[model samples]
Target: MAILKHIANKSADYGKVLDYMLFQHDDFTKKELLDDKGRKMLREEYYIDGMNCEAMLFDEECEMVNEQYHKNKRYDEIKSHHYILSFDPNDKEDHALTGEKAQALGLEFARNNFPGHQALVCTHTDGHNGSGNVHVHIVINSVRKLDVEKQDFMERECDSRAGFKHHLTNNYLRHLQQSVMDICQRENLYQVNLLSPAADKISEKEYWVNRQGQDKLNELNKQIEADGLTPSKTVFQTQKQSLREAIAEIASTATSLTDFQSGLLENYNISLIHKRGRYSYHLPDCEKNISERALGAHYGKDYLLQQFDKNTKGLEKENTQPEEPQKPISSSFPNEPDVSTIFNPSYDYGKDPIAILFVQTNLQLVVDLQNCVKAQQSEAYAQKVKISNLQQMAKTIAYVQEHEYGSQENLLESFEEVSAKLTDARKTLKETETSLRDINQQIHYTGQYLANKKVYIQMVKSKNKGKFRNEHSSEIALYEAAQKFLKAKNPDRQFPSIKDLKAEKEKLTIKRSAQKDTYNYFRDYQKELRTVCSNVDSILGISRIRQQEQEKSQDIS
Candidate 1:
């Protein structure tokens, strides 16, 4: 699988980004250092290329562009954007992914996505944790230096214009993720669906927090051991992890949302909040609530409800009567009908249509058994085979009737209908999800704009513009980004209020949740239908014959 990660660099010096990629740096402070050989240490194995600028003079070029544009002067202005495309560790062995090939792919990706921006495309053979994944590091100057043709991802006019800072909007990030997936697919390397949300979303920050916490906990445990006492806790749990485990445990057994909420509160001191069809949790001692999006897709309202429904169904099944024991095989076989008559399309049985359908499909199986050379010499074996087929035919009739299918055509048609519904539901869910994401982004930028509006106004009125900007560079950049985003989103310069955006986001989130339920329902229904169809095909020997015919046709071709 190829994983995409984005990091925005705030340092004014662009060389820091390139230096980190090319040289050995202190793990703690990330400062470049010399190797034991008293020389500048380089990465063990890497392939590096520059785009729209010379590799050695990338920082100088970027500085010149910034000077000309009068942008990126603030100390806190984002100087560059770093994107990492990490391939699966197994790809080296499985797909022969090399550093050179990765670097080439990175260059192509940079040229295509971040066109006209000075970029460093480098590929490293190994990662810091010693994972032997061939990963590409794409570092691009935040300020675009040249005018270029507009792309679909370019929303603002400034995006393709010279001296415009690059914007990493939610849509642009999604586009990059899709591009990575496409590249991996085209290269026939290991890939996963990058468009879908992960079941467990652990951000890079959270991962390191957990790791550091664990290390400290281990140290404490060692101290306790040295003092001749057992440590009460052997592991460290981040708040997200605790919330995830609590929710998962309760969702597995809770009968309803109310029950789930109550259980979490009572058992774990966790508060579940469902606001505007979105779920969030507040863990004890945490000042802020964590939304389901942060926890992951699995901890969301839709998935939890689906799990509840599954638990309900499982309980119902458990309460139902047990299946009856199988009947003994009789010694004699009933009068066997002519195989041709049984399978004749025009021949219609007045009742037991399922049984008739089963017999018609299984006719070849019974005939083959009866005509078998080995069976011909064993009377008991022949009798046993006949009895087994009879029992299977009876079960087939019962199974089809229980499912409310009147005939073979009805069963097949039902399966096809459910399959089609599942497909439609999935499409609808995806669209709803996309809309929800857009609304969320809108809400985010709008909030940022509102939060920094006062600071922006102060900066505009300040006597020393450069000094004020440097003092509040972070807020100014955020305000400008949000303002630009709003302008691009609303070309007419009329933007919705933050309240309106939130309302829209809430509405979309509700719709997405409902769509998810519909998708899950249809998906489960389709799975059951598929199982029935597969079992029927297996029992009738239809699948076997189809496979044989396909093989024969392939041979002929």
Candidate 2:
């Protein structure tokens, strides 16, 4: 049986799809008309082995019935639907059938499903990771030509004339999937239920990341056992491990969405970001965000919510039970706790195991930065809300001052003082914000340096020191520069430890926040000043209106 995936081609480029399935593709360069590593050049042709020139035949049919296509002036429209039918990896029929039978089956399926639509079916015998599987590509035009005297299954179902769409409904798709399963059963070939939920699905980008990571790990493992040291695991591996630990830790305690959000923040220092319509999690100081969907079915927000709704008391009871088998997901990881500190509500981060790791090795710098960012964001939000309240108070004062102020001069003087104070306060806030950003950048460099300090020292002491030095010199140099920057701050050339530096950074961060608070307080005070200016303007408008009414009355009198 085949794994079916539907790709809606809006480019209307059926010819491009034809070129791909027919011609050679270089895996390394992703170039056309070049054979991928495993594909034989003679076998990779439009009419080679068991394949035929059916693409050209289909192109002729499309042109013959293309009358109304010229009227469409839109730059973009649904051009074609490209469906991929991939066979099972273990299926030996791929090696025996020579792709002719697969191509025949694909054509029959497409022709029956999209009767009035022009279709091109091509079979290719290759799979990702060189898995021997015969896959078929079906490209059908979006427009169903009634000039062919045939109505598509969809057109007949909708009771409408065919023109711009060769609709593939859920029932039609399921029918195609079932067709594959039936074909496999008749032929005695390996098959799977296409309608069943996929075991796991990862995006193209993540697939490449894992592919490259595995390649790197394989290369690193070839080094002989000396000093019991292996290459550091890839970032992708680290992220997966972190994600698993974070998920498990949070899931155990979280009974509701509110609990889940707080648990993630306090325990993992992960921020939740909403873009478009979906939710994703961002690590500390990282630009890349991974959706809960991408994490896995288990980690998905909806899934976790369901779990939370299902078992609150039972979940606690389960946690207290004996631990599950540790079959070693990571073969190289040491028997150490994944996280250093428990992120309880009243926990002190400075004394956390993660904080100690920052001192020992700045591996958790991103987490530390995340903590600072959330704190800053919360503080800023609170300050802005207070500013809104002050603005309302200012408007209220304006209404009262309109009657109370004896003259415009007194009000104008008060307004001038408020305006000057507001400007000064804004300047201070801007400066504080800038200071905080600079401090963060500095900390990032320092942390980077500290993280690689051990590797730098080891490389220096080794016999073949220059080998790895070149690999990590730029980051090592950055660390050295950061150290110099820190040393200059101390009059006595005494270099403070990483812990001390982090402590000092925390102090500066606090000072910067205090400056913002000062600015906000001044800004709130100036609200009454703005109200006085408003009162003066209102008093003038009222006086002018009265004069105009009196002149009109004089004419009448």
Which candidate achieves the best lDDT against the true structure? 1
Write down the TM-score for model 2: 0.44
Q: Name the TM-score of candidate 1.
A: 0.57
TM-score of each: 0.57, 0.44
RMSD (Cα, Å) for all candidates, in order, is 19.9, 30.5
Q: List the residue pairs that clash in candidate 1.
A: none
Residue by residue across 1-557, what tens digits does model 1's lDDT show?
99999999889978787787888776545777897878879888988888999887888988899999899888888989999999998788655678888988999999999999999888989765566778898999999988999999988988999888999998999999999999998775789998899999999889889988998999999999999986666768788997887788778789888889898887678899999999999877999999999989999988999999999998888789697775444435453322222123343434432233221123222234533533454565466567655555554445565445655576777778777878898888767766765676787899999999999999999999999999999999999999999898899988898788888888887887898887777776666556556656655668778789999999999
Q: Which 10 consecutive residues of model 1 have the lowest summed lDDT?
A: 357-366
**What pairs collide in candidate 2?**
1-191, 12-79
Report every candidate's CA lDDT.
0.79, 0.58
- In candidate 2, stretches whose alpha carbon ends up further than 4 angstroms from where it belongs are 10-15, 33-54, 60-64, 67-74, 93-98, 146-163, 168-199, 208-230, 235-263, 272-282, 285-296, 305-557
Candidate 2 structure quality by residue, lDDT tens digits, 365-420: 01122223233445543443344434433343433333343344544554566567
lDDT score, residue 37, model 2?
78
